[model samples]
Target: MRLWAASVAICMAQAAHACETALLLTIDVSNSIDVAEYRLQVDGLADALLDAEITDVIVQGQSALAVVQWSGVDRQELSIPWTQLRSRTDVQTFAAQARAMPRAFVLSDTAPAEALDFALRQFADAPACDRRVIDVSGDGTPNSGSDPRPMVRAAERAGVTVNGIAIESMGLAITNFYRREIITRDGFVITARQHRDYPRAIREKLLRELSRILG
Candidate 1:
């Protein structure tokens, strides 16, 4: 019985060491996010990915990340492919690559629900990740395309956690709407208190989320 207990302990240790987690990050590039704001948010996200503290928890080849930019309607474009965030160097490389990605398309209206749908499809076939998450950022409520309710429900069903980073320089009322209508359990929302503080808010929020997800 003693030998059996030791064997089980070893197996559990190995299993824990071999665990890998996958996470997806989505940014809004819709019209509401003006040109200057767009650059801030995009580059802020890139910086967050590079932060040492955020990458410290990645277990070698066992952790991965992917990024996508979403615009009006269902236009979700991949910014970076899934990559093993093994070391600080890997984090730097990934952030550099993301920073190189352009705004790609102009914005029209907010369609967060569509972004969720596209993210679901993009990540559905990813290798069996230990913990899967969809980190999304947006400024306004849904104004175009499909409704967000069904897709949000589907994401929850698939064991994917949905976190929101709502830019709220506009007001608290809109942010309140997002908190209620969207965002999932075990998830969080970070706000850009003022339009000028968007970059800082996004970077801080993303780094926090990365830490939580990897932990």
Candidate 2:
């Protein structure tokens, strides 16, 4: 009797998670970013949602989203717990929380691979998500962790699309590495070519990934 009850509970849990479209937003803040630029990225969180094209896709009670911040091999933090984006109110609240977030992890090195690993681990026990993806934004190549390519494959094997947003800084080499390394369905990287253009980059990038996914 107890085994049957447990099976029913598992099935219901799976049903709930099946309705989730979990997106992990990974923000880069390692040696590449200064204080001002960090604020720019954080401030743009609201724009990612309230922007016209983005709002067109937010079906109430359908999408569940979360955020993960990564810098060094050991530096990874969860900015917002997973929540259902059911209304405009939810987006506003998430933006406020992210903007007001105090840095919980230190910036030591750029471990893009570790970021990918952390994101995968976060989904381990969660309900099964339909469109589970990791959006990794960065300015340069991996300097201090496992190679990102292998982790990219791991993500693909797990059915998580790994999309990228490469910052086109004056000194970096990974201009559009996302295009070369990531290969999930509809997975592509957008380049801003300048940190000053982060807002436009974030808005355009999110619209491409998070909008009309159902249509």
Candidate 3:
């Protein structure tokens, strides 16, 4: 009986290390986003992860999460290293780290394509998962770097899904831009009417995306 109990514990520990999905949350820190707006983005994500529903899914699914801050063509930083959430405590710890994450780039151009490319490359170091997704949130369209369409195609070929959250102020122009150029065929884009709306939108987006993985 003792031997059987020990074997079961080892199996459970190994299973806990297997990630069901890998999620890379990328934030845009371009010149268009002021310091206050940057705070909203990071804080919003930190809060979103702590949501009951989001936390449940993350813990249950053993999801791997990472954060990337992106700006110009050559400016991108992995603000948070990949961390797998095996329990609610793990999720809470990651949320705290996210809230305290320092700004990676500022006064730089918006380069979604380069950002996407950079994000895709990081998966090489992440724990192997059945599904991979990149969640990109930005206030404006790309102004520098190569066209994003090709990069979107590259993501598709690599079996990675690219989703977007458009933080728009006056119109749906950014939303439309994201749909047309950023998200993959199997992915989606959520619109935050304004920077202040990011928390709600990000929560909604995470629920949808993670639920899909769970389903």
Candidate 2 per-residue lDDT over residues 3-55, each given as its tens digit: 99999999987664354467778888887788887787778766777775575
Model 1, total clashes: 1
lDDT of 3 at 82: 95
Segments in model 1 whose C-alpha atoms lie over 4 Å from true places: 1-20, 59-61, 213-215
Could you estimate the TM-score for every candidate? 0.84, 0.83, 0.93
Q: Judged by lDDT relative to the true structure, which candidate is superior, 1 or 3?
A: 3
Report lDDT (Cα) of residue 154, candidate 3.
Answer: 94
Put down candidate 1 lDDT per residue, 82-187, tens digits, no spaces.
Answer: 7766667778888888777888668477788888888888775565666788878887888888777787788879878887777786567556766776677667
**Which portions of model 3 show Cα errors greater than 4 Å?**
1-13, 213-215
What's the residue-level lDDT of 57 in candidate 1? 60
The candidate 2 region of ten consecutive residues with least summed lDDT is: 53-62
Candidate 3 lDDT over residue span 6-64, tens digit each: 99999999887778889999999999999999899989999999999899998888999
Residue 6 error, candidate 3, Å: 10
Best by TM-score: 3
Q: State each model's CA lDDT, in order.
A: 0.74, 0.74, 0.92
- Output the lDDT of residue 69, model 2: 79
The TM-score of candidate 2 is 0.83
